[model samples]
Target: MHAIVIDDSSAMRMILKRIVTSLGFEATLAEHGRDALDKMDAADHRFDVALIDWIMPEMDGLEFIQAVRSDPRYDDVTLMMVSTESDQSKVVRALAAGAHEYLIKPFTPDAVAEKLELLGLLDPERVTAGV
Candidate 1:
């Protein structure tokens, strides 16, 4: 599967990329939401998933989710918010805005696998095998 990792912090992006790559996803990195959108627009193949940070410089994750959902071309992409915003209201807002899943910051690789499994983006056997 192809994935996009969107975060303002390069460190965080790298971390996510590593986890997704280990889970068998080929990932593309983006500094922020706008950069992510540009990358998506320029891609020859559509991404299967997007891991987005909630707060960003040009566009926030919520706005990015909305934009992606609004575009029919991205209809099949699953959006997961990987953010530090753990408040119930923020979570609700993100889900209402079109996020398929939400992962709080400081998550373990297992947590990511669980979320992907819930989204049906990861095979059960893969997570069980600890891949």
Candidate 2:
């Protein structure tokens, strides 16, 4: 599957990319929400999933999710929140705003795999998480 990693932090993006790649998915990086949207607009490819950070200088993850969800072209894309915003209300709000999954920051590779597993994007028994 093709996934988009939207985070202002390059290190975070790298980590996400590595994890996504390990899971057998292709990942594209975008520094912020606007850049991500621009890339999506310019590309012929549609991402299967979007892993977004909650905070950014330009546009935040919630805004990205809302924007993508509002557009028909991205209606089928799975949107997940991957950030430090682990507040229950925030998670609830993100889900209410169309996020398919919520992953807290500093997550282990296995946690990501578990989320993917629950989302049906990965096989639960096949995932080796601690990597």
Error of 2 at 64 (Å): 0.5
**Per-residue alpha-carbon lDDT of model 1 for 1-76, expressed as tens digits?**
9999999999999999999999999999998889999999999999999999999999989999999999999999
The TM-score between candidate 1 and the true structure equals 0.98
The lDDT leader among the candidates is 1
Clash count of each predicted structure: 0, 1
Worst 10 residues of 1 by lDDT: 122-131
lDDT of 2 by residue, 26-55 (tens): 999999999999988987888888999999
| Best candidate according to TM-score | 1
The Cα RMSD in angstroms, rounded to one decimal, for candidate 2 relative to the true structure is: 1.4
Question: Per-prediction TM-score, please?
Answer: 0.98, 0.94
Global CA lDDT computed for model 1: 0.95
